[model samples]
Target: MTPNPATEPRRFLEHLYNAAVRRALPLHNTAAFLPPPPKGRTIVLGAGKAGGSMAQAVEALWPADAPLEGLVVTRYHHIPPRPERLKSRIEIVEAAHPVPDAAGLAAAQRILAMAHGLTKDDLVLCLISGGGSALLTLPAEGLTLEDKQQINKQLLNSGANISEMNCVRKHLSRIKGGRLAAACAPAKVVTLTISDVPGDDPSIIASGPTVPDATSCAEAIAILQRYGIAVPGAIMSLLEQGALETPKPGDEIFTGHEVHMIATPQQSLEAAAQEARAAGIEAYILSDEMEGESREVGKVHAALARAAAHRGQPFAKPCVILSGGETTVTIRKQPEGTPRGRGGRAGEFCLGLAQALQGQGGVWALAADTDGIDGVEDNAGAFVAPETLSRALSLGMKIDKYLDRNDAYGYFRQLDDLVITGPTHTNVNDFRAMLVL
Candidate 1:
């Protein structure tokens, strides 16, 4: 039975965001599948926005008889209020993200050191998540932190996908590409992660410090050059000579390494679907691995929404559409020649969708990074109600112009549509939903 259109829209959007957060929480879905407690000691080490929450979940689930203790790094303000006893077992340290800092480097080094002096009887429980790549930064022998900072800025502006960015990171870091797990000889490494990137390739997340890397050093060099990013001559020479080899699939270092994806964008989208159903609406998930230019993705979703609104071809009216995954934005110009824009993939996506939407009636949407901060900006993402563009016009602001410069955060903030959730203390990539009624 067709119900009221007014109430359906708001409830649909709420279900979508709630679904994203639900999937992020580390609830054990499968008890038997969890790794067994170690005979020796269990050392937990990880880096990412979700590190704190992941650690807490581990402590709550793991048997008390086992010796579980270690350290992890999360973005600033990502650490959750921990249970008193769990805090003593797992040390959560906050650090800079989307950019490396001294604290991150120090934490990376300490994690590597912890991997040392391990035996076959011991176990290393690595809790890796989406932002781990940024949270863990250990430069190669010749490269300085400044060099990494510069290259990172270039990549951010390049609009390269996470895979390409991670490829370069793996070769230049000592901790990544299964080096950490390799350090703990004979000790079994069990890595549990919440996959933020589509495809959930373990090696790409945090550059796969505890997992074998399929990407070669040559590929890394190619990525840098393909994106026109400059690297130090010494670094280039090393890559050219194939001296910086990351662990590959066949390497014995990962013999006993086991990785489990505890949560993912797809799961989050599903949660949203359940919420939609409860609200007397039908929900259809487009895809969990959507990728490409942020604007282009927005255009695609816009087309779908338009169809659903006017013709209801692919989907009928009173239905909510959802999708998840990371998207890239290529900055055409940087005024100071310093990359571009402050907002992240999520914010950009909303801008693209909003502009394409053209303030259509009865269609409300929301886009945000599940981890809270979108890109480097202060907001999780933004909201697009029926009057989104109309509201912007009331303030005499042009959102299209902002989109042209990759400045969605700036555009939305003016109208106060930016969704600021601060650091969600977790990341599952971007979550987007559009309700058509």
Candidate 2:
């Protein structure tokens, strides 16, 4: 069979994304960080997009004779298939993500309950990653699951960064922000984390369920106020009185606990860079801790790519630019009776990139969430070609109209450019690559 040369760049972009994801998989990165078999049982409690995979990794590596059992919660459809001849000891459950639900609330309550009755000889293995905040939902005192879900949805569309969102989540949650760690005290907790947040701050990843939090309820209140999210009087009273403050550094509960960041955005980016270099393509990696609105970041990347392609001042031709990090999108209010927009950070980025490129030749780009879903949409992300804008215009698709409505998914779906990889079962946040030839 002959391969089409015209699609080579697009193929390479997908290859690069796969390489980045491979580097962050728990099977590849978790063994070395595994702790010694505990004198008592090893209770694995976790929640996130990667929870199922991380549990499988632990099951694959741990001694078969050791006592291993517990439950982990992951997003719906995120549980990977068990390998042939691979027996299961730990239980994996699925729940809603990016928003709290009744299932998540039940799972969180069960996980916290399991933490009780632990002895000093027991080992509590916490597998944490991105999306854990929503998957492991346990509303604080006086707050209902519905309240948490509404607040979560608001914060997601409020343009707040991950840290700010997590802060609020920690303050409002019964299990997050070191409360889980506190619950498992005397059991010697060990957290194996896949970092999906900027700076790999343990406190922000999964709202730091098994780690101490430095943020206070006051700070969370301030963030909510800054974003114009109205807090109920009951929750407001708790925040103002500092009754919901998270466990801080030097807390007695974390005396012997340990946290190991097994995978991170920077490491994944480096892995992709290595693969690009092996293919004889010069690669440059921007920071892995970038944070901002998705469209603006896309414009900045477009400018850099254009400068490299046109001027050749910063970078030479035939090169690839890579980056990783989480970005936010402020959902704009639509006109009454208008349809809601569909898409996530990656799609929005492509919208801005395609508009700014203006059909510039010799450049192609792909932006995707490593877990293979952008926002709640079914696409990992989308592709941007030199003729992206022109093709859309020819199809009667207005780039500005979609951008205004935050409808990158709708715009890209019409052009058949959406990248759908389903669930990879692991998340290192967003992956972006631009190929300039």
TM-score of each model, paired residue for residue: 0.95, 0.98
Give candidates' CA RMSD values in order.
2.4, 1.5
- Flag regions of model 2 displaced more than 4 Å: 1-7
**Per-residue CA lDDT of candidate 2, range 152-176, in tens?**
9899999999999999999999999
Across 208-234, the per-residue lDDT of candidate 1 in tens digits comes to: 888888888889988998999999999
The residue-level lDDT of candidate 2 at 125 comes to: 98
> Model 1 — TM-score against the truth?
0.95
Clashes of each: 1, 0
- For residue 413, give model 2's deviation from the true position in Å: 0.6
Off by over 4 Å in 1: 1-5, 8-11, 28-33, 84-87, 334-341
Worst 10 residues of 1 by lDDT: 1-10
Error at 379, model 1, angstroms: 1.3
